[model samples]
Target: MRSGFDCASFRVRCLHADRGGRLSAVERQVERLPEELVNKIQAGEVVERPASVVKELVENALDAGARSVHVDIEGGGAGLVRVRDDGRGMSRADTELALERHATSKLRTLDDLQAIATHGFRGEALPSIAAVSELVLRTREGETEAGTEIAVSHGRRLHLRDVGHPRGTTVEVRDLFGAVPARRKFLRAASTEAGHVAEAVTLLSLARPQTGFFLRSGGRRLIEAPPADGLAARLFQLFGDRLLEDLVPVEGGADWAAVRGFVSRPDRPRPSRPSLRLFVNRRPVRDRALAKAVSQAFRAVGGGDRGFEAFLFVEVPPHVVDVNVHPAKTEVRFADGRTVWAAVERAVRQALGEGVRELPRVEVAAGRGEATGVAGRAAAAVGTFLDRGSGEASGSEIEWGGAAGPPDRVAEAEGAAPGVEAPVPVILGQHRLTYIVASDGDELVLVDQHTAHERVRFERLLDRAGRHAVRSQGLITPLVLELPPELRPVLADHGETLRELGFDVEGFGGGSTRLSAVPAILGQKDPGPALERILRDLADREEAGWAVAGTRDRLAATLACHSAVRAGQALNRESMSAIVRDLLQTAHPTLCPHGRPTVVRVPREEVSRWFGRTGWRRS
Candidate 1:
């Protein structure tokens, strides 16, 4: 059967007959939707959640030249949300038009879109918000005698009237997404949603230091930041003096594009990259290229493996950067992204150069605590052994028990065949208590004591874990750690994996965890720092979509790093010899698990060339 539908009246009718003389149904596949339906569709994109609503409203306030903004929320902003700002308010006519789609004073024409100086220019915030919630907007321009109040529900005007109000704007929203039950059902728990709202406000607060921001949830103040003198003061106000002292100032760039802000010192690394905040032209954003630039700069200074906390600001002409790329405006497209990346990298490198302290030098003393020449100082610094019979200084060679025995059982477990022997380097004196000086007949070898042991321990630990033989050391009293809400989910997801690696952890209500035991390999070392590092590594790997085997390897590597000997700790001859022997027995003798060189070999010919004896024969 064939039938036709009237587009105007949406009524079904039999229109024509088919080839078989039977009527068929025919309907218009495409038609322009009504304005109300259009607004509801736009709301799907502009208002993702309560946090999205908060972001749009706050951004509008900032664009209005507001010096102070306050936000209050209830039921994670799904029940009610109120934002008040002290700034230039709109008049009665403008206030009424503000609720209309595509009605904005910030954008005059297409050319204005290319150079957007304001936080909002699309003018879809008010209308989109009003489409899904009950909203009340009140405003009073400075010259006006009375303010205008408008009430709207689900994109329909309910009432409008004149009222007395301050010379600013206040917007109250209630029953967010009430008309759209599907969207409301997707919202998380109140606490989780509130955390997202807080994060959104925090980013905006950091972006604008001269403006004061206050946030309250369930009638309790969450964030209260007053106007700050500068970025440093703002950082101190938000994160306190400890973070302020850990950061180094960065300032440099060309006139076309400039960069400035603060980067964390090498020693103060955070577990994740969220601690690094980025802003362009006073707008907070998340850009992978800019973040990669910062990471590359920190990697040069021996950091960035774990993340670093930084607050970087980039200033470029509006025409060169497009902030309209994302509807939420959290992403940007640069005209010349490489140039901006280089500018950021160079500025951070310069700052690190000035902020990082010089490496410590080992001081040497002469005979009986008396000062000596360079040779005596060098010998003493390397801990030269004295001859027992004559009481005279021996050569650099340190006496070991004997040549290394057969391959270690850990190596055998790691795929090494039985009865296999690995060549061991002759143990020489230490170098600055960091490197282990050794000789392999034709080459002078230098081993990083820390990484050497790290490799050895890593292999052993992996072997034990594979065999389910990991040893645990129980604590006399359980240790309690208060974790952030974000980390609690990570802990819950990976709690089993943690226990498999010799960590006995259990949740103790209120976003805290109880630690009952740790890997015995940690020994007397404080397990707090190591446990935290492991948890962070697990979280990062899980987010990166690592396989189960890869996650296990990462956990073992983290445990090995904590149990290994420190760089500055003094090691005796036996300790050094054992590390060298075990390091060679491992499958990979040249590099550590983290890809750092465990041993560096300088050929005899290279040393001879340095001494200008490459081709000399007793001449």
Candidate 2:
């Protein structure tokens, strides 16, 4: 036993000595990396993927004062990326220096960094990109008879020569990350990478509407925008007239900081916050506070919990905003974030208020031949009824089959237990063709007609969907829709779900779709608007990380909202009565599918107290 223990101890000591000797042999030192390695490392930071390469090249073209820019990509920008721009080109000397790290003409001193007006001030784009791929740059100035052509391979200059070229710059990058297998391996599928590249180009095009931008991938033209007159024209060109009509112009701010752009109407909200695009000094950025402010402003003016779409541009002194916070330059830090937030909020609020005022008012025919605004007429009728101390009216009166009751009549009257069904109330009339004014014995109940109908439709749709019994209604004349290219794939992906919901949709080619049928519940209503809303919702759901069940539920709710009666539509007594009856029969009568209140009850005592008649009752 003693000999065995001694042998084990000796082996352990030998192992420790071996480790110490190995540690002592290795030197602890630091040294600068070689130029090639340095460039490759920089590329890792600036060029995350093919999309990053496209972004840097495009920004450079725009910064060069390019009036027109054309981009072509192959293999989702992995095999080749070429950007040709009609911008100021570089001389032979400048072209050679452009491939070197930390070489830029946009900045001279440290102060210049504080007020960067150009997008390529960092000067790291060229060298960093050249480090990981084969690059060829051909540039010619207006004064030069011949252009300079420089070829580089993995941070090494291969050749420089004079060639005949136009007065612009063309950068062709091939085999991106060819030398860095690690990065190349991390790239996603070709289609996904192509999507990212398209998004980058779209953002840049949106920022510079005055410049013509064209993009082609795999020999297919993806985006083509001519020089637009302004932002509105650009929007119309990109998204078509349907989306443009839904946006209202927003303009306001102080001299120090100003904001201008377009915001979606409160009634036409999007499904996700990413729809809100924000730009600071004509540069797209992601700022949470600014985005939140826009949402808050929308909510302040009756835009509910749903997401909103906005294109807001904030202009401030360049020094007041820091664009160097990230290597990608997609985020900005403001000097006075609070002030900026307040300005955006105020501007959006004012624009929404003005938009609401400019909207066409609903007119209702009164006694004789006179016509008055819905709100004015509704108020006058309510006042007259109160002064006369009566709950009865003649024309337009909708009778209830059961005893009068509120949304929670049993609880309010007899203090009954929860879950007891409320009696159907008498539908007195409609207020502004929106709310159903009802009399629940001694209470005045206001029911949102749209929401009430929406609830009924939602419950029915849910039941039908669960049982896989949704009915379809064919149309005589098919509807054709023009959608953005990126959204076309969404339809194909959710084609099964849409068909289950009673829509017969098929691609009509080139960003157009044909709708041959729709859900029978929609009746004669125009499905164009509703279809657009559903498409947008589905697109948002793709990135929302929701389960399949949640997505189906959302689809059902959206269908119900579009199928139900609109707020401004005039409803007859039968329609009003049907809505009230259907709503009461629903499992959740008090709330809509989106969880908004469907009915609001003003107790008899509360109304009487306002008129100093609480202590008196009819004898």
Candidate 3:
């Protein structure tokens, strides 16, 4: 009995040694992750959110030559996302291969990567999306009589069957990131996600104006844009015709490249740039170099502070621009960035010179909708957010919506007409000769003289821009000035724009130009210093590799700055009243051309609270 027990103990020790050997092996060795796990890890990079999934599927449809594409989303695309397209679909075998990583027919050789024209060449989008969601693909190829339908969930194929379908494709994704709940927690609220999805669709539709696009949420159609011939027509369809007054068409080309797009004029500015789009080879991309060039061109014209919007389309040889910079394919690197920058800058300059006229405002169909789907999301994101700088009004004759007026309204209410204009404030006096102090019975307003005048002049310039009728003051003695050789091109390129701004410049041989006239708004001030500053601005711009184009707005601002009523200049009450009237008439009365607040209002109640004479709310 004792020997039997000893043998049993020996066997137990042997078993423990064997287990230890196995553990040692495991600790020393490294094994590749399972295929499913590897695919899921790859999916983490590509399928970031519902919007990323939407962007990929839409691009795939577009690459397939879809004439009309439709997107449907629910729960901000977390619950379900379906994309339908009338494009050339794939066969059963190709559809099966599409679920696998790195399986794509878009590229063949190394050279194909350099000149990628298709929106999606990496086959990663499909496999990555399928790895993390329940994906269903229904496709009917042109050669096949029946359609092929495949179901995949979490990188596993559930079924592949023949189904009846039209000659197109449909992709549906359900419960995105369901297999990985950790990723799902990172998603934003439904409305914010919907906004991002809507923005993606808007940008894609803008890039492909020839293709029709429709987006819906919860079975309600939000966007329905038909195929259009030009960018203007497409923009009109997406944003409505209010943009007709804002957009300036810019077109320019050189030997190797061409650029054509629309830029907003200086007067029409936004706080954020939601609509600024840039495309290369018909693919939408966010290239900083191109955007910087465009911004610099606009700034050269004093439209920098207002925050401009533009849709710039650059056409270059596909090989010259690399579209494979990022996995999402939203960025591109140009081969010769200087050439592209020069082209874009020149185009904007020419377009600025040819002033944009406000076309008849047409009703925007997208604007008429509740805040639910694509229309609402896109419109809300891009609509004018009336952010009054400093959150105060400038001029005294302004209406403060429905809640502003005298506290004792009954006294002034007798026999007053309902539509009567708000009474212009009485000018109390000037503060330090820089600010105009005015009282409207409730509050005292302080207006910055320089900023106020700048705003007034900018509006006048915009109004005259359409008519090309800026009054000119002919120089009593024609100022013939010798300019540096570098500034000669600035004169030649912007000659017409300068003339329209009331500068009559004639160039002569050997770096000499004669200035016969200047803007009448300059009054008795010397034009010599202003002109020199403008030349210096142009020269500095050129030195920075930006085109010295689109300087009309800048020149106007320069002229206004130099000619505005100086501080300490004593003005009579009539002049102050006239200034106040003009100030109220200007659009964007709160901010100057440079985006600084022109006025600060101090309420009488606030002053009383500050003196501790009455109870006040502590902040």
Candidate 4:
């Protein structure tokens, strides 16, 4: 008497098929029951606190393939968090099951946990979200274009109807922990909670290197990590151009996993390890054991407390690590993380030994591109970085001053072709990067290697970024960097500062960043060298708290000295003149970013005395 097939047949099949499948019927029964119990279960996993809810919902959007996710929170995660994504939307029934515990399309069995690849494998995120907070999810799917809204409070689902929603999902949570007053009492200060929320946002944004992210709290935008095309592009977009300089490429794999990130040079260490970022399959993890191995290897390569920064990507078979280890997968347990550690150590060591880490950036002496005796050793140190990708094609030779990474280089290789005059003066009458230039004046001028050049460029771009939008050129090739857990925090804390200086700071996948665009001046050098040098510079600057204005000035002096250009480099005629002109246009051009006088013009008499043409004249 019954039809050949039944509508409920498909869902019923799952009851006997597997564990996750078996739970589907139970979940449906639970959803039909009083909504209170249902919401409470949902709240258990999603709204533990402000950051927890933020993390869950954000992950939901990310898993849905959101390219640009926006999070707006008020009074931290406690007041409200409205997350909207430009991903595939949900239909009426999809929205209903979405708010139920253990109901998910991401998994079908417990065995799925072993190879969990998506950001949200647990079906609990959305439901857990509706429990504690007044949750509202609005969406539209393919043909169900009118879109519907589902509201749940204290674990009860509201009616759905046509709502003004475009093509994706927009979830809003208000008064988090409103039902659970006890939980409210445990909340931290707004700023502290805001910081946690920011951190959560940063982590998720990093996991999806190509996805764009925006976070705002109390009506103020806290973070904006744009979608990058590739890993290096993402790194440059978020972390800044400094991390790209003098980068050593790391290419190695072991036990079915491959790892890649930048290693800082000996001169590039930072005071802390914040610059050391690491990612596994593009997810940043806090694996102490694995990070320890990196620390050891980094130390072996030489930059002391001033350690380096790397945007590393480690691709492992999904089964090797258990992503289900925690609600927040920030901490990972790889089947063979130790093997990863050893491989990283060896990769870095070999990179340094082969001189792969020091591709044409700071620390190289001032000279024509040809390597001298010492330069040859320096080149050897950076060889690993140079080996992997395309090397600079200029054949112009390495022209570097012992200086910090250019704020400009974090984005792209601005052509050597000079358009706008560079703000900084060059050493020995050179064009900005050309290193030499011609002048129309009677008196010949020598550009100060570092300060003069930086002064003009720094002021120009810093001002430009402030006045208009920050100008970031897309990099044709990206520089990938790898780092450990310890240094990633420091990078997070100081990301705002670096961004002001022209870096695109975001959590690159897990700990790895995909480099994208960069500033124009840095040219084609990778960003790791720049990050390494800045880390060292920051270490010196942070050695003392900005004690006072005087103290700050003193710190600036030190940073300037460390960040300034050093002696010995070749220059082309136009580059030299540009440096001279840029200096004349800037303040304190005579003195560098540090207090050192960039240039000390020698008098004709002094020049003559070297040949015994004249003696000192009486004043």
Candidate 5:
């Protein structure tokens, strides 16, 4: 036991100990680097991300007024990013002047940042990117046979070299972040880098509907939007066939002048509004007012809960909006933010009212019975969801199935959890070959036709997997996944994660992914696309800030969920039963990792109430 005075003394002593006057001073060290070193440092920021380099080159191409933009990248642009456009090329004077800091063909006065209309008006972009990487720019006039090539690295102009190039400008950046190893280490694997690069290209394409675009990574074509008349056609390639039918054309104007394009499908929305690409005057912008208006408009059409992929373009006069707010050139300041907001919301409201085309529901083969595999979870809860049968829809069969259930019983199962507080699965009257289920009282549980089967499949799979814990099923023929080279390290770091998920990933000599074994649950599925989907999901998750990969077992569970049977699969009763039993035994039987309700429930009492009756009063 210490006295209060002693405790006070102890506290005072600790603060006094940290007092700088009581500590000894160390000698100071300072040094100055040459001018050359400073330029290289500046270059590092301009070309920090792969997208940054691409933006710089593309801006030059756009500012040059290229109708067609072709971007080719390797390793997600980490290895190399090349942008070629059919625009006015640089002359000897232009090439040399372009490399100089603050040299520009766009801005004269600092105030010009106010009415900036070009895709990019920043004069710093070119020199900044040039200072950090091995940059080569070759340009030629349309009629010229020979072109001038200028090479730069770390801000120093390599001796001017003459080269033959097409009648346009081609800018190539290789070995990004090479000068700064710290930044290089931050880059994701090449494949992921390529995906980001692809996203950048998509943004650019959306902004310039008139530009003919061709994009490829690792020699594989990502997009080929070759001068299409409408944004719908472009979206069809990036998203899917859904946008074509769901897109609602918006045509309206406010005092500031506005043109809007929005997609209105309630079923397909992302979790964030960042997905909404809003542009002003051919420049992609992330405006709070515009985005809020779009959100409100969407909420009006379909409640606030769901998300829709929207591409809304709003064009204001150059004088009305200021584009020079940020160096990245993403945000904007409209003359009247509220006016722009009102116009954007009005346009979307009118468009949603106009209505888009809806496709008829086509039932395909989905498991209604026992979903005993990885994809069978949701299917087990309800019943087989709608499935697509052999169709000429796209020369492939689309299977759809309903939740294997008489949807009402899911409520009873959910209720049993709070009252009983045990592992027992409360069964409701089973009909339509489905188990309507809810778990932990509140959260919904849904079983897919395939996942129901997967539970059973994995049970059998694990039983077989017990002895060695290393089951390698060699494919008849190995499948190859072409990825950008930047992602090479991520694969190397998470090798065990791949193996545990039933992916026998072997590194092909070059920067490529070779699959020898795939998860057993994917039954006869093409391993290439499956792996890519999983990888894409992983990459997307990385963006969402969930990067703690602690244990292989947990990671395996994640991959298993990803590779498991989906709800939209087909199954029979036997498979569904195995899945139901397995889920009941599993510790986490309530929700998927993503927090989506596995299934929703409607109790018998609730169903009776709908019929103007009550379950509590039995008369």
Candidate 6:
């Protein structure tokens, strides 16, 4: 305390200070990142994996107006990837600038960004690839005497020279992620990576049907397609003639928007929904709204098993579509998603409506022959949906929903001759009180009771509405509730559609709505959430120019789902029979409106083999 500068005073004097005040202990330092590091970071966004590399290169090839594109790969593209294209190539100056960041010929100003037609407008693809791998670009302009070659590695230009070459472009990428060991370590095995590369090639080839595409992996050709006349021809070239059998053509449009594609018949099903490929403006995109529209169309056609196969191409005005939403350009934003959805759904439905009458019926017949298996006694024990009469089968048609009856008597009710034509499956016993097992001639059909009933009610409700407006039941007491601000626009937009679906909802002062009536089909269901769901759906895409007519069907589906019978509940044998009869009368009897298979037919011979009954000759 006696010195001129004490310890406390010295400590206070040693503290650092900004012009305004003393610096904090944990202040962060900031500076411009190195160019190499910046490029690497940006590359991470564009080039996610080997398949990403393939996507960018192919898109560039397309943007260059390539008529034929060849993709060659090795070691799942981790070893080598090459794309050769016969297109309008670039000159020496363009080749040099292409490796530079943000240098693109596709865009000039703000107007181009708003209406981007070309695929690789971002110009980040080549530079991004250059940053991660050893890249060599050899390009020759159409009228140039010679070509320009540029070699780059890890974002550094190694060499540039002139060479004699054809009027085209070839880009080769090797040692991908060699400089970045962390990214390389994440690469999958060669085969797995190769599958992704093949898929990417397939998608691009499908998008550009008129362009020839050839893809090879490990020197083995994976896909090859010649130029196609149209989308249908391309599908045939890609998927083969077998796919054509299951597909139905769908085409529809509004003033400036249109949708055209093929949807598989409800009967021909796959294990999953991957087969549903949707393209927007000639570019393949995985969009939820478009996919949902296709699915809804399938459900309307009664697809209640596995999902369906569909290829829908939606064409909208370039200005109305935004392709800049994602770096990959696979995802897009539409100005009026609801209009597009409505157009697609209507197209699919119209196609199905026209072809439903021509659809072939499912049939499994046992060839007429002596009981060579030597187990004729077991035939009667094993029930079938088809009752083959000796001369004429009796007890085939059962009076379902009347009263409990003997199984033999029920079979006799649906009497028919055991001939080429199979009778309706005789309702057998209910299994687990859920499935209705029925026997036709040589097959056993298992019917999901709940989903089947739901389909029935759904189709019936739709038919009722199509003929006349859905009836509304007035609520005893009007339910008043608060509405979200987003839902307000929905009310304004789809008020007529909601009323068409049997909902009477109106604004009840500030941010609240009063629900006075509900769809009579809903019965005792709470209309609150149903109405809210409709509103939320409507609000999700407000600018969709057209009033969403599908809103009625969606609500109808909800009502049907709620009203459908539950499993584990006991249903009389006659009631089960009635359900089956009603189901068969509907448009798509095999599946429910939700695309779940309501009925599955197991062949009699296959069942026999399961029980160790063999020695039967092939039919």
Clashes of each: 8, 0, 1, 115, 86, 32
Clashing pairs in 3: 301-554
Best model per lDDT = 2
Q: Write the per-residue lDDT of candidate 6 for residues 1-619, one digit (tens) a residue.
A: 1121122222222221111142232231211234443343222267767888998998889998999999988887988999999998887767766766555778665567677788876666787777778899999989879898988776666777898778889999999888778789888656557666867877788788999987777775566678998877777765556567778898896667798888876544232333567888888788877777777776676543234678888899899998777767778898888888889888988887776664443221221121113222122222122221121111111112112132223223322223434345787766644577888767998898767776776787787778776667898898875543324434644567667767788866444578999776554344664565445433332333321136666555545554454343334455567667767777777766545678888988788889877756434
Q: Give all TM-scores, in the order shown.
A: 0.57, 0.61, 0.55, 0.52, 0.62, 0.54
Q: What local lDDT score does residue 130 receive in model 2, on the 0 to 100 scale?
A: 78
For residue 82, what is the lDDT in candidate 2? Answer: 96
* Model 6 error, position 474 (Å): 67
lDDT of 4 by residue, 1-619 (tens): 0121121222322322443443454323112223443333222233557888888788878778888899988886798999999888876656666776555667655566677777766566666666667889998765555897988765555555678788889999998878677779888656556666776776666667788987776665566567877666655655556555556667775667777766655443232333456777766666666656666665575533333456567788888887666555666777776787887777766666555255334443332353324443354345322211112211111223212233223112212324655544333333322233332332334445455665555555545656655455555666565532223434554556555444554556544544554443333354554554454344434433432233223323333333333333333333344456656766566765444455555555655667777555433
lDDT of 1: 0.68
On a 0 to 100 scale, what is the lDDT of residue 23 in model 5? 28
Ranking of all predicted structures according to TM-score, beginning with the best and ending with the worst: 5, 2, 1, 3, 6, 4
Pick by TM-score: 2 or 5, better one? 5
Question: By how many angstroms RMSD does model 2 differ from the true structure?
Answer: 13.9
**Colliding residue pairs in candidate 2:** none
lDDT of 2 by residue, 375-494 (tens): 333433332222111211111111110121222221222122247466768878777546788887878989887678778778877788889898777878998876554454456556
Name model 3 segments beyond 4 Å from true. 1-44, 267-275, 356-619
For model 2 the TM-score comes to 0.61
User: What are the lDDT figures for the candidates, one per model?
Assistant: 0.68, 0.69, 0.64, 0.56, 0.57, 0.65
Off by over 4 Å in 1: 1-44, 272-274, 357-619
Q: After superposition, how far is residue 532 of candidate 2 from its true place, in Å?
A: 4.8
Which residue runs of candidate 2 sit more than 4 Å off their true CA positions? 1-44, 178-181, 269-274, 357-480, 488-619
Cα misplacement distance, residue 222 of candidate 1 (Å)? 1.5
Writing each residue's lDDT as its tens digit, candidate 1 over 1-619 gives 0111012011101111112132122222112334453343222257778888898889988988899999999987899889999888887667766776555777665667778898877666776788788989998888879999988776666777898889889999999888778788888766556666877787888888899988877775566678988888777655556557668899996557799999877544233343668899988888988888888887776453445677889999999998877767788899999889999988888888775565222343222222133443343333322211112211111221111111122222223325756777787867755678999887998999778877887888788888898888787787776543334445655677678888888877444579889877664244554566566555544434422246567777766665665453445555667788888888887877666789999988888888888666535
Q: Model 4: residues >4 Å from true position, as ranges?
A: 1-48, 246-249, 274-276, 305-308, 351-619
